[model samples]
Target chain A: MDWRWDFTFDVVLPKMWEAAGVTVWATVASFVLALIGGLILMLLKTHRSPWISRPATEFIEFIRATPLLVQIFFLFFLLPDFGITLPPLTTGILAIGIYNSALCAEVYRAGFQAVPKGQWEACIALNLSTYRTFRDVIIPQSLPPIVPALGNYLVAIFKETPLLSFVAVAEIMQISKLIGAEYYRFTEAVTIAGIFFLVMSLIAAFLIRLVENYVKRSILH
Target chain B: MVPRIAIVIGLAAFLAGLSVATFAELKMFLPAILRGAVVTVQISVLSWLVFMAMSLIAGVARAKASGAVLWLAVGYIEVFRGTSLLVILFWLFFVMPEFGLTMSPVLAGVLGIGLNFGAYGAEIARGAIGAVPRGQTEATIALNISPWNRMTRIILPQAIAIMIPGMVNLTIELIKATALVSAVTLVDITYASVQQNQLHFRTVEIFAITLMLYYCFAQFVRFGGDALEERFSRHLSKRV
Candidate 1:
């Protein structure tokens, strides 16, 4: 019924700041993992052999189709039974990273597909090795367009960090829930957390847009 | 090629064998999981309808409405899009009760998913509408068509065609998002599987089923959306 400015500023704000660090760290770490995993998946799917590509494609599809929350739960709860227990933070990052890699893989694949067949033919005609073609010819060309899409996933994975809370990772959402339970006042803590998320998302979106424009302009030049 | 085919068949047999072993344990949990799957479908469908309605309203407002309405629509989209859906669900379920605006867990889930995805849908809608071309709207205006008629008869058909692919992506995302409803204590498939896993300690078997169910649902959305888009744009093809 009433807003508690004092409580929000003195208590919730400081706690959320600490939690925001964890949230940011988790997001960045997972994003790095996603980038690597996604590229690998994309390359596998684009392999010349169907034996390798078909299963890789199917794996990516399976991950993309499933929910991140379920994946997190599966990893957190089930892995322990196999004597493969991970720290909550590790599990959180791995779960989110693996889940998002599928999406990023699709983006990468699209990026690859968008390159004209002429480019590949030219590489072949020039006697470029496969590695040289991908590194020198394909990758640089494919990357710019994919940057914006990857950036979207960055923001997306950031928003999804809250799900880590479900598995007991002390991110902003988890901390806020604790604050709510502790103070018996849900409004201030939850509202502050929401505000934090909103601000971060807006900033990420702005940065991504800036990067997209810069990439476009550089490509044109 | 022969080796590849053999490998594929070998992999299939291995998976079938694994499933058969798991099924012996999974058989008892099938009913609960199925019931949860039904709930997942229900939530996705219900939330999708709400999301579509909100998107249409917000999207149209953002595209055409004047001044205050336009800002309000933008505000809605940004706030919902920017905030985490889990936080929103928690706020709806926990914080709203403090203000005497209590919602049932299911309602909270629906509202949360609907609002979140609706924000995304608004952007898609705006883009699709914008892509309908200036000439179409100009011709409608030249004909002195009513504003509603201009949108419905002239602009919307084309916009809807452009919108369907994006809408399908959003729908699939929404279906995946429905899993979050379990956090709010809704008996969705994710919740049911989690519960069954906790009880039986059969995480691999249970979640494997959950994953397959979600994949099937997503594929259905993809196929269905493609079919609808084909139907909607059939006239364009005929004209060509």
Candidate 2:
């Protein structure tokens, strides 16, 4: 295989960098939605009794099992048939948020599980209400440890932003495809896009690792 | 928070519109869409079976391999896991032919799904194998069973039991990845949705239906996996 190093520099790098901004925004916006949706779902699952609990649990399970792409398509493509016309970017962000929320819910559940039973008893003995217990006692304690998992999913959702191209969102992958078609250099275009993802993920991971270490140190003291 | 609230309200309104548009599509294309759903199910189930077999093989290789074999297995897993399945499908379908390895669209899609899932599965398999009690392998060795027999009769069944939860999660992932086969032009649910959307310009209706179809199918898989896990663990627990 002939490797054209200069082609990537001249043709692919600048185009992909421009596209990377759009992708990063989509990921961040979607991640915010995910965090909120996931928090709500986790609270629902925990606070509700059997009737509501079962449905919430099942919904989370369903979202967890299905692919994010199908969910995105369903929201973006199918909703308009019934009379909803959203911008492609909005739809892409919504879909990512909903799908990632399901994942975050699972992560929250695991984090909650990791909380020692004594902590719960301590909250109860202090006469804290359930809401206060969760907000003040549980979440603050559980949230820090799950930062790594949350960070991992953030990276995952960023990688998956490429799927948004199917809906014609002009994210990084869409940009790559555009440049590749124009230049007839799929290798350069795709490789540069891949590097963008790799670099971004590495930076995000390092930041998360730093946060995790800081949290650990503070908790120890 | 305000933007997020607006988004939620917007989504609710969108879903309301979807119901109206959905009825419109249903009047003209329900039969065809329902038929396409059947194809979607067929692809999901068949591909899942293949994924399970390949994942098991890949996982076993990952867990048991040493020296160069181990690195090769690790590299295989990393590449497949790292790249988007869409990129891989494009290469498999569009580019492989340039190298004289053309595949039928269905086979190519299945291979893409199988290989992608296999890579993820390998890691899960390694985790499951590591979780198995250490003495189990030693006990088999002491009994003088052939290594293959020992694996088939001893470690695998137990590992399968332990790995059920993870496998169930991966199965759902496979279901989602199948949508990418549309890139190679498989007329699965996503393709069907796109077609209906183009016909009616009611993009939301077709996509909502597609989402529900996948959600229901995924729920069924999760339930079945959990049930099977319960059954397997019961027998193991009883023996202990």
Candidate 3:
């Protein structure tokens, strides 16, 4: 029941901020993987051929239906059975990437659907190649609408980085727990960690809203 | 028929092979993990109930209110929606204890997930409520139905049907959020897996089993949600 202001000020503040850097890095790396991975999955599922698309749909559904933490645990622990051992950070990043990819795939699909069929026909009428049509016309039109949704998911992933602590990737939560264990002032340690997450998420949300506003204005214009 | 029988026999053989390979390991860990699974289900169900109740309130407030109440509801939705369940879990576990209010780790976890997802559910509920035609409310009033009855019988049931998809997504999210409870030192499936991995150094096997367990649990829930959705839609169509 006793709160320790000094410990919050002296111990947790400094330590958590330092660990926050790792959390941010993990978020960035995982988000990059998620973006690329999601784009690929989205493209695969939406491809012209049923042969390629059907399997991708099923795979995405499987991934979407499962929990990410379980997938992270599986990757961290199970990859070794196939003789693939990764560092904790790598494992954490891969897990976030794969899990977020499934959600992002849906986002991208929705974005793709939002593109009018007329645009595709217009591109084809102009004799643009499929690659050029997708790159120059379809994707540019489709992607902006999806930015806000993608941004929301990115922030969600940033918050989820704490789960990486379970695999011994010493992100913010793990660091806080260590600090708490060392000082026995879990109040200060965990509170500081929570504050760090809250602030980062707020900033992420603000930035995402800004992007959403920008997208809306551009679309309107 | 031969190919069908062959496929069944193949699957049986594969299952037997996996069992032989894993029985010793599973024998050690399955009982512990299954016990943990009970806690997992309890936390999941309790949080789902809490979120649904609180979300309905928040959603209705957002839908009906005009000024500061609306803003407060919006703020609640944004803060909880933006933040991770893990941070909420940590706050409830560590910060709440310092505030002279300590709960069992399980309670803390359930409340955190409930409140967090409740915010999301509120948004879905609000959207579904808004999607209900404005004419429906006018018609209910014209018919002299009590406001409470109008909402309970006419508006809410339809809104729930519409909200099912979003609610299903939130439910899956709640299931995942239960993993964070391990941080509070509760012996969840993840915790048991970690304990076994540490003890036997069979890290991959233990974690793999836990992953499969989660997939199985999640698939079951998703199936149930789908069935509920079908039932609701059928009932709605019959009414129409």
Candidate 4:
């Protein structure tokens, strides 16, 4: 195996670092959408009315049942057919956001359900509105604990950013692919991209654990 | 209960509308797509086999073994789990050739998905095995049960029940990742659907069927997992 350290450091690492910004940007942007979008979906699914609840449940199921790659394609390729032409990067972010939103909804549902039936009963006993109850009680209890899971999704969104390269977003994976094609050397660029993902996600996971501990401490005191 | 009936009726009406609207196009493409589904299932099943093997060995090693074996297993799980599956796919397919190792696209795709999901599966395995109570181990020791019998009869059943749902989730994810094989030009269902879209330029009809097909595959996997879990957890009683 022909490996070149000097060539990799001098030539490819800079390009990869620039592209890493785009990857991280897409992860954070899509993750914001996922957090909000997931809560909305979860609220709808848990609504008292069967009409809203059933449809939300079905929509979440449909999204979860299908693959994200096709969803990305469905957005990037199919939307233009209906005259909604988004930029490639926007398309990628929207697709990832929408796809992971369903996942995040499941996470929220698990956390919300784990809050114990007594809490919900007490809220009902006190005649609290659903919004007030969730905002004041249920979500506060649930969201903090689920931070680590959500953070895992953050890393997940980071991993999914590579799929965005398919639609020509010029993210890290795309840039690495182009570099490999141009330089006839796939090893350095691809391996470096892998390392970028590994290091950033490990850091994210570590930070998430610290946040979880701090949240726990503050809750206790 | 009312919602369940409504959902059934709603789904029927939706399918009726879809058939009325896109019957001709769907008829033309579905057989081709189903054939591609065979390819997808082939890749999924093969990769699942490899995933199971890797998960079992590495997961057991991580949970129970010590020293180099444990570290090696830990390294396997983290390195593969840490990065994107597509990177692994591309590495195996594109970069491995540079390192004097060559493989077919199908082999690379299978190995990529297998190795990636195997790492995730190993995590589930380790967690499940670890979830087996220490009391159970003490009980086995007190009863003087053989090691193999203790694991097979007492611990593994509970652990399997604990981990089945997670394994099923990973299997569904594996099936979804099979769609990535299309990027590597494997002519799986995703590729076939894209091919149909390329030919007819009918986006809505093709994507609906494509998505539905994948959804069915996931439901199928979930069905199997549910049955397995039922068998394993029969003694646990109905827990909410």
Candidate 5:
């Protein structure tokens, strides 16, 4: 109950807020990468030839089965030995992006599968190019149902951004740790960071639910 | 099937070639890394038990309880689900000591991971419970079964069948999450890999082995879950 208002406001709060912005940026950047990478993975996985799809499947499985922390560490520490050094932020984004692309690939695959076969048949009958069929027909129908699932990953990726701090990315959790180390008062700073995460994630969840409802209603109509 | 086997052999050979290049270094690090893997398994299994207990309580409260109890369950689920596990682990490890509350590294890791994953498991439990047909509950009530009997006998069996697959997925996730315990200084697999890499700078070989070890653990959990699901759902075919 012994809360220091001045320290909370003057020191921890501002630093945490600034770091929160970095957290959001990392999440957004990585999420975008995951989306694009996931789409490619899904397409590659669904390819007719096992030669291509099999490797893609294994790659997805490999990423999914491993921890993001190890992958981040691998990128941060190991890559430099190969003469491919990246900044911590870039490393964070790549690690999270690659890890999440697997999950997102599964979501996208499920979404694509849920699209009715008749739609594809009709496109084929009309002699629509495969590219056109996917771009115009398949993606539109499949994307809506998967919005809620994808939105869940948005929150998931947001929650995971703190892992970037281990690589010295200076996200909110890292800032809290720095403050705690400096002042030897981890309670307030860490609690504040946790509160920020709780609030942001709740807001993100609410927004995702709203989007889910909107997509459902529109599709139904 | 032919192509699948070929691909597997190809991947194995590729990994073997990479390891062979650094065979001596890998041999040096293997024992320490295996020790860390043991710790990873310990944390994962203990935390999974805690997760299941917390989830069951919160999930049942969210489903059947009312008023303050229900709100408390909801609040617990939301807060835990929202926050990062790493932050929670740090808070438990660092902050609690200031309040005259201290825990060992393993204890802090288990509590942090358990509480965080418990929230996700609660949602799965609540959903599975909801998915149980209303007719079964109605039939139990009509039979004048006690409330506890109704839940234990009729409702939970079906709900459990629905819960198994999701729980399996979550278990795999939990295993992967155990890697983060290294952050709190638990000397788990990731920590061991980092240390080995620092010592010899054979990052690729060390981490590749670490990654494979994690994959093996995940596959083990997945197979266990599948077996449990089969056992749980066995009665469905018998009834039919």
Candidate 6:
């Protein structure tokens, strides 16, 4: 195995870091979208009317049941047909956002359900509107607990970024693959990519624990 | 039950309508798609077996072992969990070959996905074991039950009940993982659809069919899981 340290340190590491910027930002953007979309889906799912809740639940299940890669492929392939050719990177962002949004929706559901039944009854007794109930009462209570779960999925979304390489997203995995192809040696670049994921996700997990502590402290205060 | 029945009926109606609309154009592609489906299911099961083995060995070790053995389990669980499946899959495909050990793409995929999801399942396995009531252990001790009998008869039964739901979720994920193998040029359902689309350019129709196929497979796996759970938990409600 021609593991060239000079080439790895000088040539590969810099390019890996450059490509990592794409991976990080895409994860952030997709996660932000997942957060918002999850909230909306959760609200829609728990809506009082069956008409609203039923289809919303099914759609969430469909998204959850299907592979994210297929969804990405579908959107990427279909868009070019309708004469709406976007950048593959943007397509990746949108697709990952949509797929993870469904997962986040389930987390939101679990969080909301964890809120005690009396809270809902209290809102009902006060004759609070649904919007007011969720806003002043439900959201403040529900959002905190789900942060750690959401953060876990955030790490998951980060790991998922490699799949974007399929559509030519120029993320670390794709960049490393290009390097390997060019150099005729895959071990060094690929190993570095794996190490980047392992280290960064460990750091993310650590940061998430810190955030979890912060959120818990704020709630206590 | 009524809503479930209605949903099932509704879905059947919808599929009937959709299939009628696309059947003519889809006829030629059905064989290829089915062949691809066979590959997908094959790899999903293959990887799932790998996942199940790793989950058991590492999970039990993490929960019950000590010293270097526990550290080995910890390393496997954390390393696999921390990294992405695609990276591992590619490493097995691209890097392992450099080590003078080459594997077919399918083997690389099964091992890659199995290793990744196995880490997750191990956590679930550990958690489930931890969830078993402490009193049960005390009772087994007082009754002078052997360790093996205590674990097999009492602890694992309850732990397995807790593990099933998480295991089911992971199994469905395994079905989905099979789709990713297509990225490595394995002609799974996803790759087949991409292949089909190039020929006829019926992008929407072909992918819709593929998605439906995958959804059905995932649902089938979920159903199996539910049945397994039902079997395991049947004794819980019995009155002694």
Docking class of 1: medium
- TM-score list, all predictions: 0.92, 0.83, 0.89, 0.91, 0.93, 0.93
Best by DockQ: 6
Off-target runs (Cα >4 Å) in candidate 3 are A1-4, A47-51, A80-85, B1-25, B66-72, B203-205, B235-240
lDDT of 1 by residue, B124-225 (tens): 999989887798888888889999999888887888888999999899999999998976888988889888987888888778778767877877777778
The per-model lDDT (C-alpha) reads 0.89, 0.77, 0.81, 0.86, 0.88, 0.89
- Which parts of model 1 are misplaced by more than 4 Å? A126-136, B1-24, B238-240
Show where candidate 6 strays beyond 4 Å: A123-137, B1-24, B237-240
Worst 10 residues of 5 chain A by lDDT: A212-221
How would you encode candidate 6's per-residue C-alpha lDDT over A16-48 as one tens digit per residue? Answer: 989999999999999999999998999899999
Q: 3 or 6, which is superior by lDDT?
A: 6
Q: Model 3 in CAPRI terms: which quality?
A: medium
Docking class of 6: high
Candidate 4 lDDT over residue span A142-172, tens digit each = 8666877888898899999999987888899
Error of 5 at B220 (Å): 1.2
The digit string of per-residue lDDT tens for model 5 on A167-219 reads 88898988988898899888899888888888898899899999998987876
lDDT of 6 by residue, B9-121 (tens): 56658767866887887686766877998999899889999999999788888998899999999999999999998999888899998888998988999999999999999
TM-score of chain A of 4: 0.92
Q: Give the per-residue lDDT of model 3 (tens digit) for B8-61.
A: 455447545866887876677667777877888888888889899879989988
Q: Which portions of model 5 show Cα errors greater than 4 Å?
A: A126-132, B1-24, B237-240
Query: RMSD of each candidate?
Result: 3.8, 6.4, 3.9, 3.0, 2.8, 2.5
